[model samples]
Target chain A: MENSPKIAANPEKYTFILFVSGMSVKSGHAIENLRSICDTYLKGNFNLQIIDITTDRQSAVDYQIIAIPTLIKTGPGQPRTLLGDLSDTEKVLRILDIKS
Target chain B: MFNYFHKKNQTGVRKIKPSKPQDEKFSFPKTPTGVEGLDEITDGGFPKGRPTLICGGAGCGKTLLSMQFLIKGITDFSEHGVFMSFEEPSKDLSLNVKSLGFDLDKLKAEKKLVVDYVRVERSEIEETGEYDLEGLFIRLNHAIDSVNAKRVVLDTIESLFAGLDNQAILRAELRRLFHWLKEKGVTAIITGERGEATLTRQGLEEYVSDCVIILDHRVIEQVSTRRLRIIKYRGSTHGTNEYPFLIDEDGISVLPITSLKLNNEVSSELVSTGVPGLDTMFVGGGFYRGSNILISGTAGTAKTTIACYFANEQCKKHEKTVFFAFEESPQQLIRNMKSIGIDLEKHIDKGLLQIHASRPSLNGLELHLLTLRKLIKDFKPTTVILDPISNLITVGNENEVRSMLVRLIDMLKANNITALFTSLNKQNDNLRPDLAEESVSSLVDTWITVRDMEGIGERNRGIFIVKSRGMGHSNQVREFVIGSKGIELLDVEFGPEGILTGAARKSNQLQRTVKAMKLQSDLDRKDREIDRKRKVLEANIAALKNEFESVVEELGILKATEDLHSKIMIENTPKTKKK
Candidate 1:
C-alpha cells in the first residue's frame, strides 16, 4: 500500500488539488461529484489532494483559492482552475483534459 | 511552512473568539478617512476591513481622493497603508500627489507606506485554461504584509478589465478579491470609472461592498464644480445631500454645508450694531452675540453702510470680523464707506477685519458658501458680514438661496459668531415682497427695513426695526440721514398728515413761526385800545367830582350870607334838605 505498483509505474501521473470549505453543502457536493468523475475517467492515472480551507488556510493562500469548491489541475501541461461545484461531469472532464 | 500555518491558525482562533461579537450583524468598525469635511459627511469614515467603491468620470479626482485617504490614514491615525495601482506607476502617482504636499517617498522610506504598480498587458500574454489572479493576490499580500498595512487603495481597478479579455473570470475574481480583503482585515478603497447606467464600469457596486461614493463633475453656467454623494453606506448613517468638493493644492475637501443641525449653543451677550442710534432700537444694546441680523432695503438705502458700521463696531470691540462684499470691491467699498465716515480700512490694516470681495456670479452658491466657510475657519472671526446677500439670488433659485443662507447662519451660530446680512429690495417694494428677503426673514433674529421716504420734493431715508426676536425693539420709523458723520436717526416729526420729513418738515416749521408772529401783533393792538378807554373814563369821573365840590362850596357861601340876614334857621333847613 505504501508503494503501490500503479503509483510507482506512472511517474508523470496527473496531480489534482481540491480546495473546499469544511463540511459545507457545496463543498460536499463538489467532493462527491469530483470523486466519481476522477475515479471513473482517470482510473488509476491521477493523484488527488483534498484541502479544507478552514483548517489549511496557508495552503489555500499558497494556491490562491478565493472561492469555495475550487479544483486545480497542477500536474497538467499548464495549470487550470475550475470554480463552483463539479456537478457537470462532462465539463469537468473536458476542463481537466481527461478521457474516460 | 506547515508549522507556520499551525501557529498562525492558533493565533487566528484566539483572535476570532474576541471578534465574534462584532460579527453578529457583520458590522465593521469604521476607519477615519482623515480628509477635511469628508468624515463628517460619512459619519466617521469608510467601513473598516471592507471595500469602499469610489466611482467617477475622468479627471474628477477619484485617484486624488483615494490617495488622500490612504496618506491621511498613515499620517493622522498612525495606520500604515498600501496603494496598488493598475493604471499609473508608483513613481507617477508619487509625483502626481507631490503637488498636494504628500511626501510619499519619505513615508515609504519610513516603512509606513507601500505603493505597488500592477501592470497588465493583454497583448503580452495569452489565456488558454482556467486560472486565478494569484499573481495579483501575491503582490498585494506581500506589499500589505511588508508594511503591516491597515488601509489599501486600488486606484481605478477597472483598468484591469480593459487589459483582460475574460470578463466572467475577472468578475468572479473581483468578488472574491473584495472578500479576501475583508478576511485580511484591511480597509480598502477601490476606484473605478463611472459607467453609463451603473455606478462603475464593470458594475462593481453589485458586489455588496460596505460603502459606495459617487463623484460628479459638471459645468454649470461655464463654472465647473465637483460634487460628491454617498450612494450607500451599509452600517452607518451618512449625509444624503450632494456635497460640493474642491481640489486645491491641499487636495480634495468636501463641503457638507447643509449637514449642520440647528442645536448649536446660543449666546445671550449683546453686540452693538456700530450705529449707536440703531443699537438704541433693540431692548438689549444690540443683537445677540451669535444671532443673525438682516438689513433689507432698496438701492442707496445705506444697507452696506449699516453692515460696515456693524463690522467696524465688532472690530472696535477687539473682535475679529469677516466682511464678504459681493457687490463692491474692497477698495471701492472702503472708498464708499469713507464718504460715510466708516473707516473700514483702519480695521483691515490692524488685522481685526478681513474683507473678502468677490462677485456672486463667479461661481455657484455652494462654492460661495464654501469659500466663506474656509475663510471663517481660517480667520476665526467673531463676526461675519455678507453685504448685499441679495446678489446671490442670481446664482441660485429661491429655495437654494434660502437653504444656503440657513446653512451659513447655522454655521455662524454654531461658532458663536455674530452674522449680519444686507439684502437689496426692489424699488418701491414697501410691502417687503422680495423673494430672497421673504425667505430669510424668518431665519434672522433681527430684521430691519430701510426705505426711501419720497415726499414733498425730496427723498429721505427711513429706517424701521421690522422685528427683533426675543427682545423689544422700537416700532417708530425714524428718518435717518447719511452724511460725513455716518448714519444718524432723526427725531420723530409729527404733522397733520402724520410723520413729517424733508420739505414737509421745513414748511411746517415756517408755518408755525408765521402763526406765532400774527398772534403777537393781534394781542398788542387789543392792549392799546383798552388803555385809551380807561383814560377817558377817568377824566369823566374827575370832572364830575369837581362839579360836586363846586356845588358844595356855593352852598356854604350862600349859608354864610343868609346867616347875616337872620336866615340861620333857613340855612339849617337847606342843609338838612341837602343832607
Candidate 2:
C-alpha cells in the first residue's frame, strides 16, 4: 500500500484579488502559481478574482497594486499581502497559517 | 515536470499553453487538482497528456474524485473539461453534487464543460466481432473542442466490458480507446472497476498509461480503510503509499497522514461536547474546533443522546450544524428526545441548525452517502452528526457502512468541521461497535462509549472515553444521567468494592437509611434531654405542694388564736405573713 497524501479543506473565509499586467510570463505564472497554491494550500475556502491588464490595464491601477503579481487577501483576517508569483507553497501556506 | 505560460493577448481572449511539448520534452505535464491532498498524492495532478486510470472497488469514491478533478480544472485552471459517464446519468450527477454547490449543468451550458452520460446494458446490446469506442471519442472531441478543453473524464469504462461479451474484441477495443484518448493529448481520467488479479480487470490500462491510481475499500478486523495509491506514474515523482480517501458532499479527499506530526497550534478556545458533564471532564473543558468524535454504544444506551448533546453544543455556540439522521424521522426523533429535554425545535427555528433525517432504506448505500455528501456541500455546517450509523446496516450490511464511514470521516476532517457520530453495538460484551462489521471505529480521531451496566437494581448508564488521538483524556466511566439541565455525568466513585451494584447499592444508601439507624451519640443526647425535663417537672410539683401545706397551717393557727380570745389577732397576722 502506498502512503496517502495529507490533504485538508480550509475552514476560514478567504478570497484573493490579483493585480496582473497583461497576459505576460509573470501574469500567466502568477495565475498558475495562485491556483496551485490554492489547490495544494488553500483547498476550497478561497477564491481568486483576476484583473488582467491584457484588456483592462487601467483597472490594475485602480487597485493601487504597484507590483505585477500582487495577491491581496480580500476576505479574511488583517490585510495580508503577498508580492511576486505564488510559486512558494510553503511561504504562502505559512503566511495564511493554513491548517495542516 | 511542467511549465505553463499565458498567451500575449491583443484583445480579450485568454490562451493557455504548456511550455513543454508532448514528444519533444520528456517532462510530463501536470493537471493540478484544486483539492488539497489529491495534488500531493499525484505529485501535481493527473497526467497532463495521457489517460490516468482510477480503478477501485464499488463504493470506493471513483466518480467523486474524477468529478472534483474536473470541476477544479475548469473553474480554477481555466482548463475546460468534458465529463463522460458510462454509469450515472447527467441529471443524477447534477442533483447529487447540487448540495456541494457545483452546478455542473450550468458549467456545461456555459460552453466551458460537457457532461454526457452513455447508458449501456449488456442485456440490451448484442455484439458480433469488431467494436470501437469511436462514438465516445467523437462525442468527447466535440465537447472538448467546443470549450477548447484541457481535461476529460470517463467514469467506469468497465461498463463496456460487461456490456459486450467478446472478451478478445473488448480487450482490443479497450486498448484502442486509451490509445485514442492519448492521441487526443488532453488530460483524461478513466475510471474502471477493480479486477480480481490486478488494478483493472482489462489489465491493458496499467500496461500503457502515464499514471494509474487505485482506490480500494477493505475491512481490516473491524475498521474499514478506503485507500488510494498511485500504482504507477510514468514521468512524475508520486507518493507511493496507499492514502486513505473519503467521498462526501464536497467530494473525495485523500488524507495523507504519513507521520504523527502533532500541532499544539490547535485553537486554544474550547467547544462544548454537547453533554455538560462530558465537557467538564476536559481540562480545557471542551473539544477543539474541527475535532472528530465517536460515540459507540449498545442499542438503547443513548448513543443518540451524546450526538444530540454535541449538536446542541454547536447550536449554543451559534454555529450552523447539519444533522444527518439516517436512522429516525426528524419529528419522531425530536419528539422522542423531548423526554430527555433535547429540544431541537428551537435550534431548527433559529436557522442555526438543519436536520436532514432520512431512512437508510430510501436509497442504496451510495445514494445515502451521496445525500450526506450533498447536505454538507450545500449546508456548509461547522458541525455534522450521524445518529447511529449502525442502523445503516439495513442499506449495505457491514461492508457498505464501513466504506461509507471512511468517506464520511475524510470529508469532515478535510473541511475542518467537527463531526459527531453515534454507532450502535448489539452485543453487550463488545469493546466497540461491531467495528469489524461496520469497520468505522479506526478512522475516528476520538472514541466514546456509552453502555448500560446492570447496577442499583436497574441499569447504570455510564459513558467513558475509550481513546482520543491527540489530547490527553480520562479513562473513567462517569454515571450519565439525563436531566432538565441536559445530560449530567456523576463523578466516578472508585473504592475497594470496585463498581457498586444491586443489593450492595441498597445497603450503601446512607441518605435513605440514616433515619432508620439510631447512632449511639444521638441516643445518648435524647436520654439526657428527657431526664432533665423530668427533674424540672418534679421540682415544680414539690414547690406547689409545700405552699399549700403552709397556707393550711396558717389558717389553723388563726382559728386557735380566735378561740383563745382577741390575742389570736397577733397569731393570725403572723400566720398570714407566713402564708
**Against the true structure, whose DockQ is highest?**
1
Per-residue lDDT of B414-477 in model 2, one digit per residue for the tens? Answer: 6678888887777656453475324866777678888888754587688888777666777677
In model 1, which runs have C-alpha deviations exceeding 4 angstroms?
Answer: A1-100, B1-28, B123-125, B257-260, B428-432, B515-579
Docking tier of model 2: it is: incorrect
> What is candidate 1's lDDT per residue for B297-415, written digit by digit as tens?
98889898899988888999999999999988999999999997888899999999989899899888877877877877788999999988999888877877888888888778878
Off by over 4 Å in 2: A1-100, B1-27, B33-41, B51-75, B80-209, B212-231, B238-265, B274-284, B360-378, B392-416, B429-447, B455-457, B464-507, B510-579
Question: With candidate 2 superimposed using the best TM-score fit, by how many Å does residue A84's alpha carbon deviate from the native?
Answer: 59
